[model samples]
Target: MLKLGWFSTGRDQAARDLLKVVWQRIKEGFISAQISYVFLSREPGESKESDLFLKLCQELGLKIYTLSAKNFEPGLRQNNREAWRAAYHQKVYEMIKHEPVDLIVLAGYMWVVSAELCQKLPMINLHPALPGGPQGTWQEVIWQLLQEEANETGVMMHLVTPELDQGPAVTFCRFPIKGGEFDPLWQNFKEKMRQIGLEKIKEQEGEKEPLFALIRKEGVKRELPLIVYTIKAFAEKEISLINHKLFDNKGNLLLEPYDLTERIEKHLKTGEW
Candidate 1:
């Protein structure tokens, strides 16, 4: 069986949704892999989501392991940056070195994986935006897209590299955001916020959004298919990483770039992919 290790922060629904897709695919025979271990950045006591994930892994009969960022505290972080980083890297290296892992997958891991860790194994990450789009945290990516009046956006599973989200693409799936159609959802969310009191919204401006609610709706719709497709490709040995670039079975770049307005127009026209 294919052996895999999962790295995540367990802070968001996206990561949970992704894990659900993986589990579903495994059940359906799309992926014949076993999760060997899980490495979390959060302290064991701090994450309820982490607890839930651990329970799921137990049900699946997978071995679970954890490393806490708190262990590498002030000495490595504030007192001396490089020394701290080096010590932290050694800890991660030791974990992977001793574990039986074939691939490393990052699911909403908040901290950047050190370069030393990246060089030790094949790694992949799921980012909120398509490759080559705006560079920021996932929330920032969504906010920027909305602010720019973008009609389309997407998610990508890409090879992880040292430079943030600048890794080569693997599989990308796009969806449309019809500005006019989403107005009702936006208005509804706004009114709900108003009823809840504007002060609550004021304190949570970045977190409150009609657009995000809509995007999340779309994510639930698309996430399964995308994860299945990507994992299937990987399981079949149909994807490769050469010089940090992703290539299809034929050695050509897998360029599944997304077009925003065009996708919206097509959906408006046919209501289908």
Candidate 2:
């Protein structure tokens, strides 16, 4: 069986939900693997969401380890943050040194891991944009797309490198964000900005903007299923990491992402797991 190590901050309900979904899939035999252990960046009483997540893991009999970032942050000033992080990751490396961990999945880990840790772990992360698309958070990506008046957007699972959001994709799904479904909103957004000025938007909550909200909703609808599908691909060995590099089962290096748009659409239509 594939030995998976799950890492998540469990900062919000969505984080917990993602873990639950994966656990359920594993239980249903949808993924032929075992989550050997779970690592959290928060300790008990640090956050209710993480506490709840830990409670669930306990019920499921999964091994749990924690190295609290909150506990470690206070000792470091800005200049020493990088060095502190390296030591932090070293402690984590020690914690899991004996586990037979094959892969590390960053479900909702909020911290930027050190390059040293990235070198040590075979990790994959769920990014909110497609391969070769925007290079920041979902909010930044949506804003950039709107500014460019782009017609397409997507989500992907990519190898986690020291560079943020620039990793090689394993699997991805794209969808059109144009035409009838989008033009009305796009027009309204442009008109609103024209009347109110972009400065006002910068002052206000950008994520709550009507255009951003609509786009995020559409993207979120795909996030859960995309994560599940991508992990399924890894579990079945259609995609894998060999010597810390991504490749197909045949050992050919994956130069491009595997597209899953049609399969995702079909699965959405059937409403089956």
Report lDDT (CA) for all predictions.
0.67, 0.84
Worst ten in a row by lDDT for model 2? 70-79
On a 0 to 1 TM-score scale, where does candidate 2 land against the true structure? Answer: 0.94
C-alpha TM-score for every candidate: 0.78, 0.94
* Candidate 2: residue 226 Cα off by (Å): 1.6
Candidate 1 ranges with C-alpha deviation above 4 Å? 12-14, 79-86, 183-204, 242-245, 252-273
**Residue by residue across 191-263, what tens digits does model 2's lDDT show?**
8789887668756857887778888888887878888887888888888888778888787998888898888
- Candidate 1 lDDT, tens digit per residue, 86-118? 677678778667886666788778777777677
